[model samples]
Target: MEGTAKSLIEQTSESILNYIITNNLTTGDKLPNEYKLAEEVNVGRSTLREAVRALVSRNILEVRQGSGTYVSENTGIVDDPLGFSFVKDTLKLTEDLFEIRYLLEPRVAALAATNATDEQIEELDKIRLEIEERIGAFSDEHIEKDIEFHKLVSEMSGNVAMSNLVSIINQSISRYYDYYTSNRIKDETIVSHREIMDAIKSRDPILAEDVMRIHIVTNRRSLSQNKKNNLKKE
Candidate 1:
């Protein structure tokens, strides 16, 4: 009987989670009343309360005096790992990190052009060609090269803060890339990188910044699309 109750509670929680996601519900969104949730999930109010209590403990929901239960402000992509059970929510957090990086990296490129040493430019060029070599043949190996190229550029900026920022952003982006870029569509990404590399190699700061901006913007759009595609498949 205990096991049966636990199973029902688990299923009920999952139903709530699925509903939140499908409806694009976000943080601070008010949850339906206990009676409503019970009706929607076809469970008793006692079971609904039990499940809601569990989620409340997990910081997924909050109950106010007369305001009713609301999805906590920390509920969605910003949800803490310990407080959230969904992997998709975790990916949303990752996407936010990437968005921040997208905003910062082009500035890093512009600074690198102003600050980089001759040897640094040479190093950047080397990685640029290496990345070009693996255009149509991208793999995990190429991903590493791709990161190396950016890391070298970040270091060339001679700004410790920018370098560290780039490092974190690169790491976050790497996770998304691993899932989104397979052999099926590697060329598109490789071509984009090549365009940026061309501007970098020419030492045109304005052009380099523009190219990098385009690349990051395109990448963010692509990643968002990939997430949607994965959801559809699921």
Candidate 2:
């Protein structure tokens, strides 16, 4: 009987997850109330509560007393699923991250060129202006804007899976920028972004992909050189 109960709870939990996906519910989106969900899933209130509890423990849901159940704001690989915390070789990790970016982002930029709305392109231009205006100001806001620019491009790709993957990578790369590449935003970085913007503006997929590759490759080389220089100094 205990085993059967456990199985039911597990199945109910999975059903809830599927429901969220099917409804296109994103982080902070509220789930149907317990009563509604229980009715929809044909589960007892107790079983539904148990399933919700399991999801909460997994960082997939949150329940507020006065409010109701919500999808967790930080869903999907909540924290450092790669065990980067235990990594002793930061340079190697940075290299690995760059390798992944090299593999993913150029294609993303190509897709963005093909799919980005005019409004999205205009937003990118605004972000680019903000970045250029903040250059040499040593503002954290500039770093955030830079990250936002990349995020917008990923979203413009019109591929949810690619957008999500890029978001995950962007989180890790944000840390890298904060720690290792802070203050490394040069005029060339701004220029490269402008080139990418122009390519996308012209709706040239090949040019967008090429410039994006160059942009990432240039930064990777700069970061690599910075790491080597720091090692020499130490």
Best by TM-score: 2
In model 1, the runs with Cα more than 4 Å from the true position are 1-88, 135-138, 176-185
Worst 10 residues of 1 by lDDT: 76-85
Look at candidate 2 and give me any clashing residue pairs. none
lDDT of 2 by residue, 1-234 (tens): 367688889999999999999999999999999899999888999999999998988779999888999999767555675667677776677688888989999999999999999999999999999988877565657767877889899999998877657766767776754432444546667888999999999999999999999999988888877778888999
Clashing pairs counted in every model? 0, 0
Cα distance off (Å), candidate 1, residue 39 = 72
* TM-score computed on alpha carbons, candidate 2: 0.79
Model 1 residue pairs with clashes: none
Count clashing pairs, candidate 1.
Answer: 0
**What is residue 189's positional error in candidate 2, in angstroms?**
2.9
Q: Write the per-residue lDDT of candidate 1 for residues 1-234, one digit (tens) a residue.
A: 367689889889888887777878778898787788789888999888888887787677788988898888646322233332345665786677677768877877777777788888777777767766766454357777777777777887778766645654665556544544654346555666676666666667787788778777776777778889999999
